[model samples]
Target: MANIFALITGLIFGFGLALSGMTHPEKVLGFLDVAGQWDTSLLFVLCGAVGVTVVSFRFITKLKAPVFAPIFRLPESNAIDKPLLIGSALFGTGWGISGYCPGPAVALLASPNWELWVFLPAMLLGYVLHWYLFKPQAQKSAAAAPENTKAEPPTCG
Candidate 1:
């Protein structure tokens, strides 16, 4: 049931990406490029997304748990740390260079692009590197740390 929901959600998301012109690397790159010919359409798309999330999360969080999941999953990190800063820098740099993020990159596989030849390989390399190099250390650190450390217990209102 959850898998079915995920499948439907992914399909809808991919369709939305395709409809929004986000599947095109050129379009994404254009939005990032400041000095060159700029495309502001994606800004509206991003703004719309932010707006939706801002509104939806407020209401949705009122629910005790997620509709399709056993637990209420959400990001607990709010502080800017060294890892966060560095990772964000790397992500931004790669996105600026290739105009490809993971979601759109996967969607790109549905279409054909020369950049995907470069993007997909590099993306996979990053994933492999993270899994092989960082994941074990991360897991050990997580295991060593106390549980429920990332977030505090919710207060009774």
Candidate 2:
């Protein structure tokens, strides 16, 4: 089942994050610190991830559907809009300040310390705020989706 595969993949990813020192906020902070005592280990980790993605993406694209799912859920939009730019800036700022991106933050939750507690709540608050701002627009799009599917005839009048 898709759920089982997702769980298994999530576990593996969490374990990998833990092993890669990503679970440690200090390590990530050090990586972000360019002029200070900068750590370059995370760069290698990122490169490794990119390498894997480059190879895997080729194979994944060839597949009609995922192994566990009927269809592969891919991003619908590719445009670099204002919201995307703002979101990326916000994410980068938060990551720079707390050194806890979403993936490592989730992994750190398993053995949560004070920092994790604070960061998680703030992270969740950001998500809630985003939903509050964007959910209405998303719902409107969904409501109009059926209309888009039904093609209208040429208007000559």
Candidate 1, residues 1-157, lDDT tens digits: the string is 8999999989999998888888887899999987899898999888877889899989998988887777776666676899788988999998888787888888878886787888798899997887688776667766777986423332210
Steric clash pairs (candidate 1): none
C-alpha lDDT of candidate 2 relative to the true structure: 0.82
Cα lDDT tens digits, model 2, 32-147, are 99999989998988888789989999999899988776776566677799977987898899889888999988888789999888989988898789778987877776678787
Best by TM-score: 2
Per-residue lDDT for 111 in model 2?
97
Q: Score each candidate by Cα lDDT.
A: 0.81, 0.82
- The list of candidate 2 runs beyond 4 A from truth reads 146-157
Query: 98, model 2: CA deviation in Å?
Result: 1.1
